[model samples]
Target chain A: MRWKLIIDPVGRPGRDNMGLDSALLRSVQEGGPGSGGDAFLRLYRWDPSCLSFGRNEPATSRYDVEKIRALGLDTVRRPTGGRAVWHDAELTYAVAAPCHAFGSLRQTYLAIHQMLAGAFERLGVTTTLASRRSGRAPRPSAGACFALSAGGEIVVDDRKLVGSAQVRIGKAFLQHGSVLLENGQDVVSGVTMGTIPRVCATSLGEVLGRSIAFEEVARAIALEVRERWSGSWSEESRSPETIESDKFGDVSWTWRR
Target chain B: MSNIPDELRYTEEHEYVRSESDGVVTIGITDYAQGELGDIVYVDLPDVGTEVAKMDVFGTIEAVKAVSELFSPLTGEVVDINTALDGNPSLINQHPYEDGWMIKLRVQNLATIEELMSATDYAQHIGE
Candidate 1:
């Protein structure tokens, strides 16, 4: 099989969510059992809502740390790079596998986005992939991830719909992103420090003209996954070799940049 | 086709190593790597005096599409990093071999560099 499906529908804390994704990425990198054939598509949600920073995003200097705490928002830094994303009321998906599973880094990114676009289509929501910008792009220094869409990102009504990021290590890589079920990214702009750009974003409910649930979105994605890859999807537990992540939950790691 | 300079040696991970002196060698991603990564937005490298093992991640390069680890090709201590990338990471997309050079290391074993892929070997490695 080219893919394995791990649907963790229950919400968990930000640290543990990021930790599982990081550990799964390492499992695919090291190459042993339970690594999934070519990829592991783990779909999950966040508990109590969380704000995640890109691995290198300057959160300590730009984000209102005190405000985030006071708001009771769980936070963690993703191993992948992009910008800050408010992971709330969303269906987050992580794909971890060998780099060659898709192809070159750029190809891998676009291919995954294509799968996501197809999934959205099954849910009757049409999406277009953003083109690569000619000049500058959104930097990791500040601003919300949904504030702008990079080339190859997924969009609807010309607003950013799915914000994704990737990180490559040796022979393997991990790419993950959020498919917002509700309009939650607005919270990001409120917490940023400087006068950052407002979020140009959309959500499944907004596009579908109704409220959307995580299960409906997950079903559409799972159907797309089945059609895209050969063989049946397996529901496997976490790989035993995956290391426990102390850093994902650590403040030092989150605020390291 | 991406240029593979004849004088440089390369790791399978796509990092190029250029001999700077007796024990010092400069490291950076190959033209092929920058091409694969697309427009670079930022570069994060280790500080001077940081020791790294061969194949260990010393830093990461963030492109518009992805962020990839920069693996150490030769085990050594960091001597310097390209601070120029702090402001204009596009230097990598513009001239990855020259202005985009990432790090300098005082190699623990100079002879190991000889084991790295030559330009001809790298061309084949990338299926050029």
Candidate 2:
């Protein structure tokens, strides 16, 4: 198997990052089976901090609009489904591949998280994949992504360290996740009405008790993905700017729900 | 194993269709689909009177794990939507075939149902 590693050097707005992820998924789907239709692992960050809610999440009801506006943070609805996430001081990764490569949806989620856990291990941070708990469901009012760990999410000592979501388009799929690098969980919990205690989340810097560079973390994870999947890695040819205009830049798409 | 009622017809996407006498059919996700989705939190349903093409996405189902597109089983116009899902989407997890029916559509062609798989075939398709 061959894979492309897209290491975005600059931080982009929430919309462009999300748009590039979708564009990669579209490219793979259009390329069809084995016509340079290789898998992709993209690493990026959000500029100026942003709040992203799931496709079905009721934004007005869950988030405090006044507080969000005062903070000057951008808000966009994700094409994938999951709870809200505060994108700041974190390393975000998006994987676009064929559905058949990882079997079922749940299987694909676990596989990606397992590889991520391995990446954390290489960086001297131990993490585990959370399992489904047998209990009552959390309230819809719980808006924060790290408020509770869903099945196959990454956790460190039971504290959420990574949050992810997926959207499948026919034979292709895109799974994107945020790997916290610094502190921002309190801001997310405070801006939302949910009760996501700061203790419930952890970051790579917090775990290591030292600062970590985004480039270092991105390289380690990309190498781990190559080793785990036994694939050769190369830089992606196309830039994200090509698809930013009509897809992510449009207000209607960002707010479409 | 998930339930696959012999009387219902199924699509490759795991939606089941039950025909009515008035050339209409009720649609819902199969038990296997609900199991895979795991604790559904929200169901994005299409409005009544919306025309949907066969195999096209009509709406979405969001669970704790992921959001999945709901593919239409046949070409038709929606006549009714399960408004009960607005308040409680878990009906799909509790009773996918009964209380969780998604929509009722005035089908364009009855032959479309014939193109679908039977219960036994659906069972085989999901490896049940």
List model 1 lDDT by residue over B11-127, tens digit each.
889999999976999999999998888878889899999999999899888986588888999999999999999988888889889999999999999999999999999999999
Pairs that collide in candidate 1 are none
Identify the runs in model 2 with alpha carbons over 4 angstroms from their true place.
A32-35, A194-199, A237-241, A245-247, A250-257
Candidate 2 residue-wise lDDT, A150-244, digit = tens: 77789988889998988888778889989999968777777775544443788999999999988889878977888788667788634545453
In model 1, the runs with Cα more than 4 Å from the true position are: A36-38, A236-245
- State each candidate's chain A TM-score: 0.94, 0.90
Chain A accuracy of model 2 expressed as TM-score: 0.90
The best candidate by lDDT is 1
Model 2 alpha-carbon miss at residue B5, Å: 1.8
- Per-residue alpha-carbon lDDT of candidate 1 for residues A1-257, written as tens digits (9 for 90 to 100): 46778888478888888888888888888776766444689999999698999888889888889999898888899888888999888999999988877788878888889999999999899999987777755567748888877788899877998989898887889999998889888788888888877789999999999998998998898889788766557765443345445888889999997
TM-score of chain B of each: 0.98, 0.98
Cand. 2 TM to true fold: 0.93
DockQ of 2: 0.61
**DockQ agreement of candidate 1 with the native complex:** 0.67
